[model samples]
Target: MAAVTRGSFSVLRQLLSQQYRRRCFRLQNFRSDRTLQPLIFRCDRNLQMFGSRALHTAIVSQGPIVQFKLSDIGEGIMEVTVKEWYVKEGDKVSQFDSICEVQSDKASVTITSRYDGVIKKLYYDVDATALVGKPLVDIETESSSEVIQEEDVVETPAMAREEHTHQEIKGHKTQATPAVRRLAMENNIKLSEVVGTGKDGRILKEDILNYLARQTGAILPPTPFQEIQTPGPAPAPAAAAAATARPVSTPATKPPPTTPKPVFIGKDITEPLKGFSKAMVKTMTAALKIPHFGYCDEVDLSRLVAVRAELRSVAEARGVKLSYMPFFIKAASLGLLQFPILNASVDEGCQNITYKASHNIGLAMDTSQGLLVPNVKNVQLLSVMEIAQELNRLQALGAAGQLGTGELSGGTFTLSNIGSIGGTYTKPVILPPEVAIGALGKIQILPRFDANDQVVRAHIMNVSWSADHRIIDGATMCRFSNLWKEYLENPASMMLDLK
Candidate 1:
């Protein structure tokens, strides 16, 4: 009876196995595609359902460390020179506080802190070249938004405010451009003691010179500016802002900017491309990728010159500096209205043109640094006097290496006024992304026959253009130049079109 029962159990197990195999075969036959491969390997059933236990990754919660990278600092520039550091490692900084100063070949930009936190590390030193989109500085802050909320509710204590005031005193320097500071130092004058006549009580070189002139007959200093030297580490902020403020971990070991290596050419000494010139060369070399053509023409600016002379007193009253550049910028902007395609850029494939809405005309100004083409926004809406003021401001900032990135951005069209330095005609390089660039040559007093066939001395200015041949044809470029000339030559006609 026991043997019979064992046989029956073995038969039932075989039948159950047969049924399972039949179901699997049916399921395989009903499959839609042959893309499903035969299982040559198999994982454990437990692992197939839920992944391997030993392979689990543990999530580690950490506070946020934010990093600020250089981006479009010089309007699509690749790298920048680290000019000066305002904050050092381990120092607490609030949002929007000045962190460091970077010098582009075109201008100097003050980088601000992006977050309120303690600076963990500074990635580069002054005079160092930092690539765009690379790490600059790191700051450690709370990962949660609650910390920011808490900070907003908390008011700074009176003692803390007093301490900050004392620190400012220790810094003991006015916010002046590097040029002004250098002039003051050369005169052995402390900037703190100088009375500022500039905007926001900022000290200018003129202020320092005036103060020194009052003290003595001339602006020259009796003694040179002395340096306070210490053998070891210095803790407090120096009067010149010589060192980075407060080091939490490592104190900043920044050496003074080195003197550029000079090249001796027989009797004269010339320096190689150092700061801004180096940048200009690099950018211009890159701009060679564009297939550009040159256009040359002459414009009679007699009427425009007369108009400027008449407005000279009005400009002086309004505290605006009047120059030929303002007229050129305005005329170019208005001419751009007739030929909007000139104020545009071509697509990468040379397939499309992007017309700009605002006529942000860039003026190429010669500076202590190489030529900088800082643009003025909405040139159409501004009067010539207003444009002159903007030009003056940009030139001043460019000289001091204090021009912001905004001043260097949004340039739809460019004007090169090399005429100021006495050039007759020059095919200026096109500042890329923009299809067209116009250069004004020196205005020559030429004796020419008028419409009445009488010879007269006319203020004739030669203008040269460089336009991308891919987007702008020779005829279109010439027409645009003629339109620009008409605005300057016949100043009366533009009055009816002024919007």
Candidate 2:
């Protein structure tokens, strides 16, 4: 009887295994069409499916939150060490709230949250290196009907555990663009509950402006200016009304003039060098190491000025304004074509002078942060309008302190426009790895003798060239300067093959 029972159990298990195999075989057959497709396509689809699952799992487990990995911070910043945490775990953070501080070799920046949620977890400790694009924290969202906490509450580490709880929160939120995220971080603006009015519920620039306007009391009218409108004394409360009552017969008397006293103060004050200030220091230091030779020349800009005015009108018609820098750039390019040696740089270690084929002009822009010289890549090939556009973009980026690392590098020549700063003439320092720098001073109408020996008041501008003495000789520098002046003064000569 025992042998019969064991045999019956074994037969039942075998029949169940057969049915399971049949079902698996049918499933495999149904998926055979997908398997027969290109292996690359199949792999890509599989990856997409896996990514979707991972994203879903992360969102569900972590709550309605997205972690901007360090990779999203910027290009080439693969990893960064955490300097500090502005917002602690479990802290209720709005979108664009500075959550943490990070340090890279290039710069120190604050990392902000991308969504409105409670910070549930911090993956990195202080000074821990977190790679770009790696999850740094988890955030749990709050419900719509839940009363928002008014008081600022500090978050604790214990809240990390609650991140795993599978609870759904009501209310949908908009995601911010990378540009908007940067703007908010720089401006200290809170994006959550800001009411986005963009398409698909996106936050536009106007929304940020509106938020700022509201914060600054834009709805209120401006206070009227009055010569004697100073703040009055505070009103006494009802309890002290009898005691505060004073005689109204006498006219209001002015307080006795106080003697001025000098306050001597001593304290340790440290000014942090950042942005363009830091960049300027680095550039100047590098330039000091190079052996420099200075060259100066005055260019007759009468023709150039007229041409610029004509071009300005044309540009206005085309909806593109032109600046004097483009004319200088073109003239410098022409001069470089004639005298390539001026554009060459000597490598002391390599014991060779390298001449660059491409003419990349670096424009010196004075920003509020500091002096910045961002380069225009391949300026020789671009038209005058293109050069103007590029210059405008570089100036805009420099002013905003948003210039990329590579945009600051790889320059064949540098142009400093001191003319904008009310200088008639000035010498500019040569940026290293580049042989020469050209300075454009203020243009003015001056009396001068022409080639025909008649005195005339002509629009003139001074061009000062600073070159590396080791690479460029005085004669070659003078030739380059003269060629540049000739191109500018003639204006039409730039369009011809003067080389």
Worst 10-residue stretch by lDDT in candidate 1? 162-171
Error of 1 at 16 (Å): 55
Q: Give per-model TM-scores.
A: 0.56, 0.56
Q: In candidate 2, what residue range of length 10 has the lowest lDDT sum? A: 163-172
- Candidate 2 residue-wise lDDT, 1-499, digit = tens: 9999999999999999999999999988889687566765656777889999999887675544444344333334566677678777778887656677665544445555545788878999987888764677876754332322311111212232221111000011234576865676577864542445675346677777765664443431111111111122355687368655754432255574588898766887786554345556776888898877788878887787778877776654544446778778877887788788767777756389888898988888775445667787676676777666556556655645545444666788899988877786777888878888988887777789988999987877787888888767899998778777878888888879533
**Which model scores highest in lDDT?**
1
Once superposed on the true structure, which residue ranges of model 2 sit more than 4 Å away at CA? Answer: 1-69, 72-117, 120-266, 271-275, 346-350
Report every candidate's CA lDDT. Answer: 0.69, 0.65
Model 2 residue 249 distance off true place after TM-score fit, in angstroms: 59
- The lDDT of model 2 is 0.65
